[model samples]
Target: MTTINDIAKLANVSRSTVSRHLNKNGYVSQEAQERIDKVIQETSYLPSQSAKSLRTKKTGVIGVILPKISTETASRVVDGINQMLQENDYQMLLTQTSLDKDKEIAFIKLLQSRNVDGVILLGTNTDEALVNEIQKADVPVVVLGQNMPSTTSISYPDYNATVEMITYMLENGYRDISFIGVPEDDPAVGILRKKAYIDTLKKYNLPILEERMAFGDFSIESGYDAMQTIMMHSSQPNAVFVVTDNMAVGAMQYLKENHYSIPKDIGMATTGVSRLSKYIEPVLTTIDFQNEDAGIAITRLLMEKLNGYNKTKKLTHTYRRLSGNSL
Candidate 1:
């Protein structure tokens, strides 16, 4: 019910002075600011976001496009984003694509139409069309998880982390380590992770066998099916390195159903050091990508762009290896 006009009259100042005090733009005398603050506190007055946006061309909100909202990675990253955004008086508008690449493209346009100040994409693949759209969009966009050459991104050290993990496996005497991974369409988890797995094996003079690799869709059932296919080979693997913790759990589930004892009959390791990985049976040896830190970094980078410091930035985050009984 209280408007800026009412506040100006009550504070004994011109409406323009009240505007400067409310918007924190231009200059207001210290005494006038004090009187306006007192009147605002007494009236519990709130500024209209629409009016502020009209004046500043910013909605005071950020749009986030997630591949899937149900995963531990998504939750942790969102928590970190919220922590930073709240401190800056910004709100978040979240949308889930359920891992649909087409939906990912659609949501970018949708968020832009909604007048979001910026967008943070929890990316999957770097499709050319998507990249071109990002290049042309009026709003600044930051990609997470996957790298795009000309865009601002906060990506994990997927290649190095996988190499480190595979090296650790080899050092522990896992010679015939089969990989359960998703398709190469997802450059971060699929292509890069698999490339590291193979390169590390070759570095140690290990055989590159076709039967030892299986592809999945980053699902538990897919992991189970991949494990089944891998087991059909005459020379079964002694260890398995899965691209994701979710898939690793799926593989473990299959191993259990077939009466295979973990670390005794077979060893396992995965990325994403999810909470469930620590609590699962036999525990999972995994890589902690520090997903929350990636979230915070992306938010800050987008904020910088919104503040007119526009340039392409690519930041690679670090990871930690979690020791567990599974390996």
Candidate 2:
């Protein structure tokens, strides 16, 4: 275990000088810095992370709290965050809250206790307490996927975007439309998409049928179940809009298994245009949410916050729509 004392003795400088040089908090002369650098290289001395964190109040680690990490979209966002963090020599500490309000609040406190430089909350559940906690802590907290009051966030237009897709479907002469989405309790749930679906139908004076709506967890299995439920209805919808690609894929699988022809039998559309969507037979019609770009934007914003830029009052990020084959 090589310590700063060993390097200092070898470099013929005081330990304080070595500490200042390694931490980059205090400056030393060029000659002394070079000597310390040479000794550090020769001795293979690595400074203690705890000591560094104490000196700079920066752990060189970012906390990423996601609502439901098992989802494909969340996984892709994590990938993008990793790519950027690796390039910047930063590390990510991931925490999954499973959309539990109590768990999310506890996670925030835990992140703060761990002394993370900042935190990126992937999504918000129904609790507003976390926003106050973030503000009181005076730490940089950036919300992704969902908006928060009195905090900075990167948001997607789930409501308007879904309406746009549904409008397109209606215009295409698809009358009997059904929506598959997550439970309304989850903040990041597909309420917006479902709302858009209902709103569009109402604007056109279409009857709102209770059997046309189905709620499930955001999973392929749930999508399959929802689709089955919708199909069991006396008057099945001619077209369906699934809130997520994962569920849409599942619905497609169920349709295929039942020997139903896509587009010919029933049209399909969904949000999120992942790679899996393309290889499917009809090539799902979806709105590309640009998840990767959103991840990059959120990470960049986190960096800006770390660099002392205030974004609490500004809405700095938004989303774009991608029209794909499934629609």
Candidate 3:
């Protein structure tokens, strides 16, 4: 219930002195700062953000737009962002698209309208219209997952992760590998990942057959269906590589039902499902993109921009391969 005014009166300082000390907008004497700090500690006073925003034109809130809230990857990233934001006394305003591309753009505009300090987008694709909208927003925007040209982004090494994962499978005698990926529109999980798979096969002189390729949405059901289709191929792949661990779980579910022994019958490896993959029997081999670390890095970039520090256009994080029994 204590106000800045009460703090100022108790500290025996003018309101402007207290404002200067709290806002860092102007100078306050060291003597005045000591008194204000003492009073604040004793009173446990919190400033009115609305009143502060009126003076500084800042909401102290960062808008986060996610492709979907249900996914573990998205949730982990948001958790990291929240960790950083809270440390800096900034709040997050979250918007979920439920994997709808149109909503991604719409939420960007909505966040701008709400006068957020900045935006952190858990991007899926780099649509031109979406890019233009971000540029026009006149606020700092940092994207996670997808890497788009002419924009700031925090991204995983998708291509490398895929290559390493596929290569590991190949090294373990998996020549004919089936891939379950999202549509090509998703640059990170789709285009980059699939490209790595195809390129890796070519490197090893393995034929990239049409039957082994299956595309699906970011869902368990889609992965299940993709695996079913792959099974129908007369010459099915000896091993399967999925873009995400969530899909891998679905594929494994199908394999379990059909009595297919993992690694012995069909090896399975995936990317970015570290949390879920460990609990499943015969643990899943996956590339750890460090989603939480990616989230933390993106928030750091946003904070750099917000604080008038050096704005990094794009930042990349390394990926590590986790060995499991499934591969």
Measured by TM-score, the strongest candidate is 3
Instruction: Compute the lDDT for candidate 2.
Output: 0.82
Tens digit per residue, CA lDDT, model 2, 1-327: 998889989999999998888767787999999999998888788888878877887889999998788877888888888888887768999999886767777877899898888888876553557777777764688888776777778777888888888899999899999889987765554566788889999999999998988877778999999999999989898899899988998998888899888888899988887777778778887887777777887888888888888856435344555655555
Model 3, residue 290: distance off in Å is 0.6
Rank by lDDT (best first): 1, 3, 2
The weakest ten consecutive residues by lDDT in model 1 span 272-281
lDDT for 319 in candidate 2 is 52
Q: Write the per-residue lDDT of candidate 3 for residues 1-327, one digit (tens) a residue.
A: 998889989999998899999988898989999999999999889899999999999999999999888898988888899999999999999999988888888999899889999999999889899888877777888888878667888778989889888989988988889999999878888899999999999999989898898878988889899999999989977899999999999999999898999988999999876567789977999888788888888999899888797445887887888898997
* Candidate 2 vs 3: which has more lDDT: 3
Kindly provide the TM-score of model 3 when superposed on the true structure, using C-alpha atoms: 0.96
Clashes of 2: 3
Candidate 1 lDDT over 147-182, as tens digits, reads 887999978899999999999999999999999988
Q: After superposition, how far is residue 271 of candidate 3 from its true place, in Å?
A: 0.5
Query: In candidate 1, which residue pairs get closer than 3 Å at backbone N, Cα or C atoms, i.e. clash?
Result: none
Q: What is candidate 3's local distance difference test score?
A: 0.88
Q: Top lDDT: which candidate number?
A: 1
